[model samples]
Target: MPTITKSNIDYDKRNLSDKALLKLYYNMLKPRLIEEKMLILLRQGKISKWFSGIGQEAISVGVTMALKPSEYILPMHRNLGVFTTREIPLHRLFCQWQGKASGFTKGRDRSFHFGTQDYNIVGMISHLGPQLGVADGIALANLLKKNGQVTAVFTGEGGTSEGDFHEALNVASVWQLPVIFCIENNGYGLSTPTNEQYHCKHLADRGKGYGMDSFILDGNNIIETYSKVKKLAESIRKRPRPILIEFKTFRRRGHEEASGTKYVPQELMSEWEAKDPIENFRSYLFSKKILSAEIEDQYTSEIKAEIDAALDSAYAEENIIPNETIELNDVYKQFEYQDIKPNSNVKELRLIDAISEGLRQSMEKHKDLVIMGQDIAEYGGVFKITEGFVEQFGKGRVRNTPICESAIVEVGMGLSIAGMKSVVEMQFSDFVTSGFNPIVNYLAKSHYRWEQNADVVVRMPCGAGVAAGPFHSQTNEAWFTKTPGLKVVYPAFPYDAKGLLATAINDPNPVLFFEHKALYRSIRQDVPTDYFTLPFGQAALLTEGESVSIITYGAGVHWALEVLENNSDISADLIDLRTLQPLDKEAIINSVKKTGKAIILQEDSLFGGIASDISAMLMEECFEHLDAPVKRVASMETPIPFIGQLEDQYLAKGKFESALRDLLSY
Candidate 1:
């Protein structure tokens, strides 16, 4: 329970023991030399590219040593020293850079974009700042479990400018999570200097606004860096709270091997060179007599020899056949249905009520389930979908969040990684654009990238009819369906909404669940009270006919049904595609083959929409059986107008009947 302060241990005194000092020194040395070796390989054309962490070894080594190896770390590209300190086999590291089959990601990714489940380290993507929020999620998970584990996340000074950085800090501060947000302030964001990047003097000062404990440390000084980080890490583990530390460091090499340092002034480069992190550490160790010149020379030779051997071994390995693992991690790796007793007496419920019931039942079933969104708890969201949720499930379980879209998904990814099922509400589907990076880049590809299942259900209330206008009325299911790894479900009726949401929450991967705003109060159906799950990638045959196959989902299903009801002559087969990504291609093909005609309808834009993909698929499969070309009826390529009459005109109101009539006649 003791805290480290200047009053107790002298600032100049050697805090770490001789053995610990040597370990820290070696941690810094190994990655510095490994980078040099990689640069050599880059020049020799053995590796495609390299991002050298030449002068930033102190921060990486210092932080890694501060935390226990059991704790999780979300490291950026430059933190190769983290891998080395964890004693990741040198061959595995080399194999990753060599793009060999034996690598962590099996040659799927390059540089430090690989993670080993055994080490509890999740490697970063090219999009740098989102990991901070993911780290916050991991920390939140630990706090919830009372595990006393902390998460250390790394980013550059440039990354602080990103919205994810601020969002993550705010969440960590509000929730009092055990996370350390380490910023490596090397004075430049790739090419842009610090002055142009932010008006604030110090990056660490930004954390004060979030009410987090912030510090500025000399990144080149090993003793100072180690002492401060070690204390902060210890304190946060006991009393969970975020700590922001800005390490004033330098990257001695180019951003990449090909990018020269011509943009930087000669004086700046020379100044950083003289105060090199690794060299400065060596001088400190020599001053303490922990490492002599003789030992240093012997150690360098040994490290160089080890790296060379590892590179040689990596080069000898075969390249991974990318096609062999092409199908792997594309969607939920595996899924299983929950056994529930079917209700003999079904109860009729509205779409919104059914969704809330599904959430309540899911939370009751799984203790690790957590609900997160803006106004979702007290106000029951903008639509009261989660009405009375907080009373049933305590505020801790049914939580309200700050208006942070990107962090919402990013935090969900982290919580999912830490074995928590997160049900996130986006208030409105149109606002999903604000938080699209984590969903598209991080959450969608998580399973594929690292076999990390983001057990997250992102509830998006979508579509028009309520006259919410451009920002609120947009149906963005097509955007997510286009993404490979995410399972997109846009249900029409109350039964499908309840069942699909349950299935989505219990599924092993990330799912984007879209509920039409118009259907919330309009539709009512007999939904089973007992826990029931609907399978993904399957379509519901609402009304079967022979003339044409009407394929649609969400609000489009109702529109198609209305057309079918009004016209008795035209017998159309109404098919609702419940799931989008794992699309029911067989059903569509069968329907088109039987009817000899097809119509793909949706509320999204005409160009580059879900109908487009369906049309392409139908053409490939049922092209020979079709009597005429496929017809797609969708909203025009313009913003949804604020005026109801104008919106109807833009949507081509009552056009589905005409489109179907034309297709049937052809």
Candidate 2:
């Protein structure tokens, strides 16, 4: 299709009513004036930073006005008109910009780095690409609900280079989701020009490769942009599908006020300034006798007065004070621990079966629960854990995803934001590196930043066994345990696996559920068929003795049990910590205080592992009760080898018995 430039657009055939036209003009003018006021505030040192969308107001205003208020929009930093058009409270927005407690983030974040459920807007993170996938999730939810609600996500031409951009577009196209990929070609990404960003002539052209319809618009023409986007949104609502629209615009100011636009040519700046969206649109309205100079002046005066009053109200709000208790409270929603017991019906099942049962039960209980992963549908996944899920739940609940880990993970977060729970499976635990950004940066920080709950459980099949080599077998749980707003669950036995998995699914936070690939079919226990939940931050005592306290979890628990059973003379207390993030510190301390010695064991490499934290905790809390120095047994600090003997040597089991003997002798 041909690019829709201003000269080619049919101005005389426009369909917007005069009232709507006037309202759009007011919305565009408001943000432009607000940005000018904010720039002054920045110079006067009232606000620390400002991202001026001074000349690029039409894209945000037109797109927001075109969509229904119930449809979601994920906007970028410069889209201030989106907030203003959505009618977000100016005082609260100013308070947010000024780091006040009354802000959406409670002063935890700055600028447009927050989202509000009330407005159906998901704000962008500094990493500009992930929000596209989040838009996919919201669109997917709308499709399932048959709400005919479309999701529009924004990014710049530079963001088109990100892998997430491609992945999200491809997934949306394949799934035929109702999404509008809005790309604002704003000349440059920070300092890099568009020529250096992508080889394509226009970012919208890339959409054709994904089998998606594409369009290009003269972004400065507010009437053309609004009419085109409105027609596009209407078509998408009738027949759900993804569309890419490239808004050809120019940023009048620097990426931020701090970054001066020295690289932009003077001639180019003069040309764009002459075609200013708001000014040109104002002339159009005057020519059509839809607006007068008196009314325009009145609108400007009203907008300036409104901004000043909002700033005054924001200044009256209290600033954020650093308090350990209050700061920690917002990290995650509090979950009430319930020690639910299983009924009389029981059967022997392996760890994998228990987990499958837990997921099945949760799916039956919560209709909104979805399980997405590559090869998880008819293929049953790499480990066959989801073998019969598709047959039981159908393809809607049991869905298959592309090999796009990063986008899929963010899609799960978007699902959570839309009040649906999702479980994303990483084929191998080591593959989480691809999905790490959304999990650690977006999902982990969502609740703390905007009180957004990421109720998604990521199933990680981790550990070094089965000779799967470095790419497949890895115990990377430590990566997330250090990250706040996330729960890490690693269970040793089938009983704990079922119960803990249930709790993780039910919890209103992001959870990393690690299932040892080696233990999937190895150990079996009489697990209750009835649904149950195990509390986090609670350790299970496998054995009771006084020689030493063995703190371990996952596969380490079974190894410790084997060693203790073989050497009865070396009696010890074995503690299986089911959850890692909410560490069972009280259990560890009490066990160490009773036994007077402790040994922390883990399957991960020695340095930077969870063992280091537990060792430090034992030293700090139970130093006086210790009869000997704390001991740590972990795998060698190297990549897990593929050879059977080399892999065995790289694991913790080889040194477990020897380490315990030395600690006992000490």
Candidate 3:
């Protein structure tokens, strides 16, 4: 509705000299050269992947130049120009392209991804969106550290559609976070043009709806891009709210090395090229007589030599890609999961109570921990996992928020990214669909991208059986179990909950801890009052059996235990997959081998469930140990019905019974 002009911005009055002009131009040229070399590397098949920021260099360089090394940045994939301003080694860029060890983060920060801890910059990009949450987090951390630094996060025109984009902006606006959101709106989201998909003509228009001060500028025009963004960056740095500047530019190349970019119209391409920011800036400098033609040539030659030398040194010194051995490393916390026998004090209690007790205990132990959710603070959460927490911890620590699922997760990731160990208590697990944009695109891939974990725990009450109806009850873990950079811990018992929750807090990864609403108050077991922890990425054998291996976790572990206890004919071994991603392959394979049958059980649908992924992992890694086709016991491939009988019937895990019968027959 309204735009803050340069005069209105506080930094507008700040003077810019010719020296400042030269530095900005140099940054643009340096990145442009490095990106071009990366393209050559990509085309020649030297690099596996490349996402170029050739045309949209103005915004990247502009905003980054404005930020100090103390001020952090959470850049998306297309912000190479910013990386140049941060002084990321050029050879490291090349080594990253070549997948060499000497590359950024020693091969961890691969193509289209880069991070250096030296600049106080924590980089994160799902290559999707939601990185703004990360920016808010880094900014929050800067605040905690009392560092007078602003956090700038970058995005694209297509990113505006994501729920996390809105979540981040809204959270920052509300909290007055020192964040500058730079959206490089290069028109097309891969193949879909913004004009064709979205109703808004200007991408920045969406930011205003979130109450963020938003602006749209020519991303290719260096002078305007820098002037506009620098002002906003400086303003946010001073007051620390949110301001989104949509840099309108065009991708000089395809979305990635694999993309051909044939979808872009010739007219749009030619028009954007005609207004190239780098060329425009160069012209501006030449016309001002700031630098002679000889000086310009030397400048280009100097940057090119720097790139070549960096590449040579990087290639000669070391490779970039992380050692293949680390594939299983960093995937999960290395905590050793042990069966801590229950003491006399650890009396059997229902599961929901046990989980609640664990939450209370963990919160008591860790003062830095903050618990937030819809009804969690005063209402004790929907499942009451946080019951009495507000009474015990008070409003500051045991907090409540507005009904914003995306905002909830954005806050969690932000707090976690900062320094506070915050857990988001979702009323029902099914509502995760509302916040899926931020969770999957940002939280899921955050650590892998930044090499820093956003240690936020999303405590959602999931699963069926309570028949809370379709909207209230659904197992949504299947949506994210396949994601790499996350920890999904579904504990079946109070002991497991306490141990795992403790483990989750200690973990340097984002964890989705599903406390089944069905089991919360109903189930009980002897849980230790003493301090205990359970490491993720490991499974446990509840019972030893020779007939079949019942592979499950969370509530399914209890169900498998029941089936095994009742029917002794088919002695089933229960293996609880404690952590979904780092998946306890060693435990799973060992159990499957010992008992040559697998019946993976979960409350999710049989189709496209965690069982499929778990079974595939077994087949690929320990396939030879199988005695029969790996089976899956899950709910019917439909939403949980409202009726009780229908719910019970639909909740059937065919594999648990059928697989047992088959094993018995064998």
Alpha carbon lDDT of each predicted model: 0.85, 0.91, 0.73
Tens digits of lDDT, candidate 2, 1-666:
212223322244366788888898899999998988888899999999999898889899999999999889999999999999999989989999999987889888899999999999999999889999999999889888899989999999988999999999998998899999999999988888888988888888998899999999999888888889999999999999999999999987899989999999999999888888877777677767787877887898999899989999999977778999988998998787667899999999999999989988988978999999999999999888889989999998888999999999988988998899999999998999999999999999999999998999999999977998989989999999999989999999999999999899989899999999999999899999999988888899999998899999999999999999999888799999999988889999999999998999999998999999999988999889998999999999899999999999999998999999898889
1 or 3, greater by lDDT: 1
Over the full model, what C-alpha lDDT does candidate 2 score relative to the true structure?
A: 0.91
If scored against the real structure, what TM-score would every candidate get? 0.96, 0.98, 0.80
RMSD of each: 4.0, 3.1, 5.9
Q: Model 1 TM-score? A: 0.96
- Ranked by TM-score from best down, the candidates are 2, 1, 3
Q: Model 3, range 395-490, lDDT digits (tens) per residue? A: 767766666787667667766656678788777888887777777766765555545456688887887777678888787887777776777888
Q: Is candidate 1 or candidate 3 better by TM-score?
A: 1
Clashes of 2: 0
Best by lDDT: 2
